[model samples]
Target chain A: MKMAIAKQEVRALSGDEAVAYAVKQSDVDVVAAYPITPQTIIVERFSEYVHNGEVDTEFICVESEHSALTACLAASATGVRTFTASGSAGLALMHEILYVTSGCRAPVVMAIVNRALSAPINIHCDHADSMVERDAGWIQIYVENSQETYDSVIQAFRIAEDPDILLPTMVMLDAFVISHTLESVKVLPDDIVRKFVGTRQIPLVKNHEGKLVPFKLDPENPVTMGPLDLYDYYFEHKRQQEDAMQRASQKIKQIHDEYGEITGRRYGNGLINPYRLEDAEIAAICLGSTAGTAKTVVDQLRAKGVKAGLLRLRAYRPFPAQDVTKVLENVKAIAVMDRSHSFGAYGGPVFHEVRHTLYDAATHPQIVNYVYGLGGRDMPQTLIHEIYKELQKILETKRVKKPVRFIGVRE
Target chain B: MTAKQKGWKELPIAGLCWKPSTEYFTGDWRTFKPMLDEEKCTKCLICYIDCPDVAVKWKPEDEKIEFDYNFCKGCGICANVCPSEAIKMVLE
Candidate 1:
């Protein structure tokens, strides 16, 4: 008889449940939360955990999203991990404090739970809220499915707490698509989650001969922070943030690979996850929940004799300029599906930036944006096929379609 | 000597050099300005306690308090929250 080795089992979970599971796994000593559209349920389960004694955390019921983040930041700053969730108006309230947490480099992990911004108050699925905060310095990882949402939440702690990148991250998941949807997921055990995430070392603090001195700053050897800089250190500060942003990409990728080893789940966070683009003519560049639809469209298009591919973006921050240029240079056409509109000048924020990044390149593909799903419009996979066909037409005739291709809308 | 230079000797302790006739965010010039009326006054430290931004300071001598305007943003909350109604927002 052959001896069998002991191995752990995996289970299925919905996005909200997965989030609660992830929060539990992160060993979050404090849970600060407020009720907001789409993201409310994620914290609802967390509250249940606290009530049932499933999670031993100081669950702080906050008045508003601003206080939720403030409490999370304050808690995490004092040498313990913290978690929270918000979307749309709630996120807007927390906007100013987001930069403060980033500036202070607090490793408070949160789930943005992507939803459409208010006014008419329609909430389903869109990247509007998350895209609006592109420069908040929070490392964003947009997930496509419920399993990935759960997985991304777990991975967020590992990535955020990395000493080289002691920065907060917002795991952005589509409101109804992933946040409310149910899917089979492998929820890692708490012990394994603890082992994988490890302990976080609080930032800007160091002990010297029994005295607690701040790490990133000097008080006894004093230095002022955020001083209104003239020409001297202004550029240097910008360069410092840019360098950290650059370093974060590689750190994120390394953590992804490590998580893959430990948990058998990995996310390609290097801006683009290229599918069948090795010898393809056109590649569809997309981000967030739309990538799932685009991937299916790519398979169908490929089956019907179209030499096209997919580049599902996972990490939009520290935008992967070099990799995008290198991979997209030789392609005849690249259709960027923009779920977020930039109002004018460009169709969407991600589409606008990607087009600009690839514009000056020698053999770059003709980039066209398909701005779809605004105010929670339906984006069927068949529309992605139509968008790709339109891209093919644009490739044949070099005529730009007003810099935007609005697909399947009443207007 | 000019009256401005002569004024320093007349001041009590820690001869004040700060100005309040100028402003930052709010335009009320003497918004945080110290008024040493030395009349109709009970110099309680209530103003200092109500100041969220710590714009007010309490001095020990004669229980009098002076304002520092070099860093004050002239938020006007100080004057509005003053219990004694001693501080007033005035145009420069």
Candidate 2:
């Protein structure tokens, strides 16, 4: 079911540059962001676009990440497209407003260059920053490379702004790995991207005056947003957020397939991308750039008659529980690799979710957790090979002696 | 008759406050209510300007001042701000 790609040009761009270029062509109305490592280039390049008269986006340089997200939330409340980027401490600083943005249904799209959280003050790549905010009600998408970064950034706006799923979204790229490394990205023409994104469709809501008006902060038809809700209605609002998240699983896939038809590029049904897993006896599940390396390992294992496969999770927030269950139900054993660890929890975030997702399946695979590459540590091909080997051994032993293992770390 | 409360599905997508704040009757929580002494009251309208809840009502055409006890939290700001000591805080 492959479709022909329309007119496109191949450009060598890093992950950050790809996000900026996609946002520039998407015709975002406003961008408010504070600069941080790995993600700084995105706003910096977009500001250049603003200066060169390439795009008429309102580029706002805020004092801090908190104010940056606050400004974007306010701008988005006015019913216009808005974007921002952050990583590491900057993402952490914008933590409080993340909940506010999604709770208010602002539909603001952000690019998070995945970086290790501080204390050690490392600026390298890891999922800890965004992974910690997993419950903040944001749609999270992790990309494998610069090309996916570019494609996903364009798709994020449509997914977040869908009328049925007006939730904020975060497009993640590994810091320094994809953010600094350049790759050949096929970009659709500006007009095509513009046409594909179209305009945000705001739903009509009844204001206090009993008149139906667009759900935005308009002087002509005023409405209060992010109002204080006590016990009387707070639970209902939280339930509505959960319902929108449930609906987002389907809406994201629909939007992904629609975009694929126009560009001939699609990632595994827009939720989890399965690689060589059709007849695989053993598989490894991971998120972000590590999947690219793991795929090479799987190919090498296949060459040696190993029935190994990889399932790269693209969307983490929605969890894609049913799809994951259907895909891995028959596999003999699985290794879930997480770049971020949940302190005092049973395992890493992805491992816990995947195991929970498979709890009721007809066939239970011997699953293990591997916390790897914290603080921007490199996950080489050998480590991925080690994981597959461990899975192979677990399949034979019929038991997991250790449910969790720290990869590439000295005892 | 009271309007029926909305279910989660029928309510606005987010917890958007579309109804005016006047919809909630906060005065029920008030233990002390403000009482005005019209005899000693000047036409200064100090209570009307000092009330935080906008519960003090003053009509320019009628040249009259009244209290909207429905929303008043009885903070006693009006009684404290009355220059002529024309307002008193009475237990509800």
**Which lDDT values do the candidates have, in the order given?**
0.72, 0.92
Instruction: Give the per-residue lDDT of model 1 (tens digit) for A1-411.
Output: 322222445666677778888888777889899988788888888898889998779999989999999999877666578899998888989999887776656678989877777777878777888888889878888777887887788888987877667778888888787787778887766787787788776444323232334433333633233334334234444454555678888887877766667665555543567878877788888877777877788888899988888887788776778778877767888888877677765578878888889888997567788888877788888888787887788778866666677777876
Task: Judging by DockQ against the true structure, name the best candidate.
Answer: 2
Alpha carbon lDDT of residue A73, candidate 1? 81
Model 2 residue B11 lDDT score = 84
**Model 1 CA deviation exceeding 4 Å by range:** A1-8, A203-239, B1-92
Q: Lowest lDDT 10-mer window, candidate 2 chain B?
A: B1-10
Would you list the clashing residue pairs of candidate 2?
none
Which candidate should be chosen as best, given TM-score against the real structure? 2
Local lDDT at A384 for model 2: 90
Report the error of model 1 at residue A3, Å: 20
